[model samples]
Target: MYISYKPLWHTLIERNMRKEDLRLAAGLTTNMIANMGKGKHISMETLTKICETLNCDISDVIELERE
Candidate 1:
């Protein structure tokens, strides 16, 4: 299985937040956002930051998916 950021995109939409906004609020680099866009693996620390900034749980940001 692979990790998917699909839930993150939905959460962003529900919050009316742009990727740039999330990057700034979460103190994330542009490259990190880019990697997420590509569904690439990111560190748990990064996920923690995102969850904290968005006031969401990890499952709200990512999910395991079958290949």
Candidate 2:
């Protein structure tokens, strides 16, 4: 299985937010954002921060996929 952050990107676009904006708003580091861009897995704590910052749920950020 693989994890995808497609929904998160869509959400950001819908909110008119840039990656930098999300980093600042969610207190995430540049590395974290970069890793996500590369389809890397992040910690649940980080995910929670993103969800809270965006007023969204975990489902709005990531999804599991069969490879």
Candidate 3:
């Protein structure tokens, strides 16, 4: 299975927030944000922070792709 963060990007767009805004609001590092941009797996803790900051759920930010 593959993971994608496309949903998160869309969500951010819907909220009129930029990637840097998410980073600051969620207290995330540049590396972490970069990782998400590359569709890399991040820690559940990080996921929780993002979800909390965005007022969203894990499902809202990420999806799995079956291969």
Candidate 4:
């Protein structure tokens, strides 16, 4: 299974938040954000930070895909 982050784009749109704003609010570095954009696996702690920052659930950010 692969994880997708397409929902994050939607969430950003719904929240009217920019990627840079999310990075700042989540205390994430550009490289980390870039990695996430590339669908790289991130730590649970980082995921939690993102969820908290965006006031969203994990399902609002990541998705599971069958390969």
Candidate 5:
């Protein structure tokens, strides 16, 4: 199975937040945001910070899918 982040992309748009904005709000570095854009694996701690900053659940940011 493969995880996809299109839903999270949509959510970000709906929230009217740009990638850079998210990075700033989440206190993440540009490199971290870049990695997320590439769908690279991230630490749970980082994910938690993102969720808290965005007031969202993990499911609202990421998904698991069948390859």
Candidate 6:
């Protein structure tokens, strides 16, 4: 199965936050953001940082790919 961050993208839009804003707010590197954009894997530590910054649960940002 794959993971999708479409929820996270929608949440960012709802929050009026740019990807750059999330990067800075979450203390993430550009490479990390790029990875997320490409639906690539990142560490849970990075995921936790994003969740904390957005005040959201992991499920709010990620979902399993229906295959």
- Residue pairs in collision within model 4: none
Show pairs that collide, candidate 6.
Answer: none
Poorest lDDT segment (10 consecutive residues) of candidate 1? 51-60
lDDT, candidate 4, equals 0.92
Winner of 3 and 5 under lDDT: 3
Instruction: Give the TM-score comparing model 5 with the true structure, all chains together.
Output: 0.90
Q: Report the C-alpha lDDT of model 5 over 1-67, residue by residue, as the tens digit.
A: 8666777788899999998888898899998887878988778898898889989999998898887
TM-score of 6: 0.95
Stretches off by above 4 angstroms in model 5 are none
Q: Report the CA-based lDDT of candidate 3 relative to the real structure.
A: 0.94
Question: Lowest summed lDDT over 10 consecutive residues: which window, candidate 2?
Answer: 57-66
Per-residue accuracy of model 3 over 1-67 as CA lDDT, tens digit each: 9999989999999999999999999999999999999888999999999999999988889999886
Query: Each model's C-alpha lDDT?
Result: 0.98, 0.96, 0.94, 0.92, 0.85, 0.94
Best by TM-score: 1
Cα error, residue 57 of model 5, in Å, equals 0.8
Clashing pairs in 3: none
Across 1-67, the per-residue lDDT of candidate 4 in tens digits comes to 9998889989998989999999999999998889988999888898899999988899999999998
- lDDT-superior candidate, 5 or 6: 6
Off by over 4 Å in 6: none
RMSD per candidate (Å) reads 0.4, 0.5, 0.7, 0.8, 1.0, 0.7
Top-lDDT structure, candidate number: 1
